[model samples]
Target: MSIFSGLQPPEAFAEAALALGPAPLVACHNDADGLSAGAILVKTLQRLGTEPSTRIVGKGENAYSDAFLDELRGRAMTGLVVTDLGVSSRLPDLGLPTVLIDHHVPTGVPTHACVVSGIEDDPIPTSSLLAYRCAKAIGVETGDLLWLAAIGLIGDMADEDGFPEMEEARALGITALRKAVSLVNAPRRTASGDASAALGLLLKADGAKAVLSGAHAETAALLQAKEEVKAALDAARKIGPKVSAEVALIPFSSPCQIHPLVAQAWRTRIRDRIVIAANFGYREGWVHFAARTGEDRDLIAFLAEHRPPGAGEEYGNGHRLASGGALRLADWNHFVHAIGFGPELEAAA
Candidate 1:
């Protein structure tokens, strides 16, 4: 049976939740897909007359932890619904019914939970789309909010042609959808409120049109952050490009907090090479690495197979074509050498 077979459609999921009596504690990732997924589930639960508690965890390493379990134990929620996350973390026993809705490749599906992910037979879909399926199944009026799923699809850079639902979302117009995606992602690392604020705006406003019209002012941080990213991109560009036989590296330090946008910008400019943007996180005493490769190469697999022995101190994760993580300063030379690249860094010693 498909792992997703155990997960019910939206209406059935809602019915099962209703049967459970107590509301769920919804944990979402702090990204466009995750934020939108959480909002969709939370709003649907509210519509079902259950007020669910919610929490946000950082991208990869911080998604599941002892503190997270303790937070859940302290809550009144009787169930757990994790969206756009949990695939990377070992799902621990919370002694409650747990459902994980995620899109990333799972390390291993925990036997203790019902997992909705892109694994084996299941085609990868954004978590927001999965949440919308549930909301639609529940007979909730979702016509207005359907565009929210499209925003996440674009944010994740997923191809929209295959899914008719995504096609319908794309029909809303490209300008609006792209703007909405930028609004969500631009502030994700530098500021906290932009993505949430955009989600709220999309959910409450009159669909995509309203979101497109007002996203600029509401996410003004996006504009400022873009400028900062542009400067970082310039610095990365000036570093020219260093190459090994297998890959290219563009290492630089930014005065502003390193957002995914800056890395993405650098990736677009240097598409000819397998680009690794290593942002120096001076304050944290580590270097955060964002790697982008072509369709033929698997960034995650490469990172796994060539990971530095000293990577024990690093933290982060990402998808196949693109991924990001952090490593301690001490691991710099080992990390470069591990990837079959000669080290060109000043010795930390």
Candidate 2:
């Protein structure tokens, strides 16, 4: 009757875990997907009589940077598990036994270790699903984590296609999480700094009821923030239709705090098959880019190839059409040019 009852882990993953001794190091994404994956890993390790040191990193942050590599060296970590992130070519350089369990489009598979992902060839899977399989491989059979895993799936927009099994597992629980996600995703103005507070509430909430009740304060705050998001969206719309033929650009100078919501608003107005909305962030030197693909195109693939150096895919749970990234303010013009938009479009927006 457990959600994971019929699930089986890969043979290679079991072999790798067996080869490595106790006390593994887990590097996971900071978002819902990564958090759920990390939680599953923790439970699995505990069941296996092993301990794991957990570290959370933002998706947009450089996972392979020298600082991260140096941290790994300092830990003297022998076994590494990366979840909910795309595999980079630099992964092998860390000089540790590694296992990759992710759901992103891979740049390339690692030659030095076991890699598991959900690329085009494989049936679509979430990082939490991969983590659950890994847990099963190690003989851990807890089903309590399904709700958490479902949160990642919904947060990443994976629910669009509708995973019947996951949906059945989530049942009424997902409704509360969706409300929580919406409240947390509200826009920001000034430096009220409610975004982090919202995320904290979602992360710590005990259950569906707790999550909903905990978000009340944030929801109130979001009611006020919604105005700013609307204003930015309105501004973007004023600029979009005129610039459609010349260049597709949605520009707003507002210090919008909720990047995703603002982008979604702009996208709603765009009738084009492909629309990209650019917005000014709280920081003066940066801009956020949200690209929404028409039904005809795959925005996930497009954003993956076009993302800036520091950018990472938002995953939109599974709404491949909705994706976002950030770019330096200085590179804004160059990015627009690279995307094939012209100066006239810039002028119009």
Using TM-score, give the best candidate's number.
1
Tell me each candidate's TM-score.
0.82, 0.72
**lDDT tens digits, residues 140-179, model 1?**
7777667777777777777453766788876778787787
Please list all clashing residue pairs in model 2, or write none if there are none: 156-316, 156-317, 156-318, 157-316, 157-317, 157-318, 158-317, 158-318
lDDT of 2 by residue, 1-349 (tens): 4221212235457777755458788777655566667767766766777777777665235465666777778885668888876665567455667887877655545676577665542347678767766766666675665665666666666766566547665665667767654544453232343344444444455544565573446545555655666665565455543254423456655565445545565566655655666656445566665666545667766655554454433222234666656666545555566566666434222
Native-referenced Cα lDDT, model 2: 0.59
After superposition on all CA atoms, how large is the RMSD of candidate 2? 6.5
Error of 1 at 70 (Å): 4.0
Q: What is the lDDT of residue 124 in candidate 1?
A: 65
Q: What's the C-alpha lDDT at position 265 in model 2?
A: 59
For model 2 the local lDDT of residue 150 reads: 67
